[model samples]
Target: MTTGDAVRNRLGLGRLLPLGVATDGAWLTEEAAVLVLRTAVQRLPAVTLGRVRVSLADPAEAAAPTVPPPPSALPPGALRIEADFTAPADRPLPTVASELRELLWSTATHGLDLVIEETDLGVSGLSDAPAGPAGHPREKDMTAARPPGGRPAQPQGPAALAASAAPGVAHLASTLGDPVHLASDHIRVEVATAAGHRPLAVVGAVRESVRGALGNDGRPVVVLVTAVGTAEQPAEG
Candidate 1:
């Protein structure tokens, strides 16, 4: 299905708001945060935002809210906001790709640089058994000639099985083996400035864009963003 249809089918957000922006040391109410996350995921089928939990790093500086309010209950003024869009663990990866495409389009409109880090979609483990006893019962003579295992004598170890099984095993290994459970499609965006950027607004825009792109079959998309200059630096070698 198209992006819009997918978002509508998967998530049911009616009216979306414009982009929301926030900065460090800001105070965003819980309700507003959820709204942003909900809207974004609704649009991006590949993205599935789960339960959101907000906390104040410094209770003394900024006290925590006893009961989090809905998106509408967000208090005026900004504080550093960290919004996490938790993806569905069970959904397939292709669906996520469609949603991410939409998110990128939206962020582009606002002159933001969007980057996606895809999770590794690889097979972790595998087990296979030889085809159970190939011939029918009447083939007693052939069976008798075979080993006690009642199956063809397949070779064991790399030297014996390399020529026969290498190609299949290589293909399977490349496709399914990933040690790190990285997201197949991880997305990140960087807005030039946090001035006009509201967390809720950016997320909402992303959501709407994804929904518009992926329609009914939109997959779960995961997105994260930061200001242009605030990105964390890697450790020095």
Candidate 2:
């Protein structure tokens, strides 16, 4: 198989739903695609993403025909994405928007290998600086304790659930500041280690800690410990 096929196979790409009958390849789910793009945009300097939406430009056009077309006949630009965000007010509005547009375009076309017909970016507001990607309040602490007489809110989605569980796992593993990447089915954490610490022991501790913390959430969790003694790093795509 070719390199692309190999990569797709490794990623379980065959399971994804196809964009249309014409395209032989499948496309990532709208949620996953949005997450990928949102993460990329959130990382851009001075940009704070507020809301994101991803969908087809023409739902009717994307609807599959009775007879599936051949792979060679697929049309391009099948997907459309919309994002609302704030950027530094000091930067020229057009310049900032253009940069943001280019970043989104490159990430979709190159990183995700997905064709996007359009990226509609709206400058909803301006922020002085970029917001922390890990600044989700739920991830800050996972204790059952809450303000007296106040009930804890339920986690309504995969992302929120993962964020809620991350802090407890981090605390138990003694890597309270490490990065956590959460998906619907899995959670990958980076655990820290020291010169005298046992590498296997640390990994085992982290696994047990997060597993216990998560406590039968129905999602299979995967906890990964970073290489021993590596400096803390941000989550990467």
Candidate 3:
């Protein structure tokens, strides 16, 4: 059956009499339920059912601006964009991390190499336990806690990672903290760059390329420019 029909049938609202049920303020008919489902489904964009990817790259030196420039003076390559944070996992912690890994793999732009590095989870969640053996009660109840299973639970086929990641991909894009536009399923990042083959210029080019590839509409997109390098490095002037 069609999706709408399926929804209607499931709700038991397919084609009964509306008025019969409504004498005392009758209930909706099966047909009305089907219609409602159809309308609701139709309202969602087609892109919502499929995966969309956005790419990001570090900004080139010329693109890194110490001071803001006039809109007219801005070059096209100043925006470094990445589609990292598309969605946040509804589940907490380890599950979220696992979901993030899947999302990164699934939503990565085709032809780009992407990998998830093991991040330092830090001591925040750690706990002290009684110094004891395997079955000791003092052992923090590890039974209730577990890390997200490794890559195996990822979406499962060749692009399983990407597929699993698709649900939460928007979260990755949010980290960029810049204005972005989404059209259809594509995302666009706006940026400015400078002339010449300097480090800043190269960075800007990278930024622009990512912005172009990751452009999306109807979804959140992240545009990150390499505002500044590591703390030890001097600020661009």
List the global CA lDDT of all models: 0.28, 0.45, 0.25
User: Which regions of candidate 1 are displaced past 4 Å?
Assistant: 1-26, 57-237
Q: What is the lDDT of residue 98 in candidate 3?
A: 51
- Cα lDDT, model 1, residue 205: 47
Best by lDDT: 2
lDDT of 3 by residue, 13-114 (tens): 342211111111111122222222122222211101112122122224223323222121222221111222222223344553354344333321111111
Report residue 226 deviation for candidate 1 (angstroms).
22
TM-scores for every predicted model: 0.21, 0.43, 0.16
Better of 2 and 3 by lDDT: 2
State which candidate, 1 or 2, has the greater TM-score: 2
lDDT of 2 by residue, 102-168 (tens): 8787766654445577889888988665444432423222221121111233443443344335422
All predictions: root-mean-square deviation over Cα?
A: 25.3, 15.7, 23.8
How displaced is residue 180 in candidate 1, in Å?
51
Worst 10 residues of 1 by lDDT: 168-177
Pairs that clash in candidate 2: none
Ordered by lDDT, highest first, the candidates read: 2, 1, 3
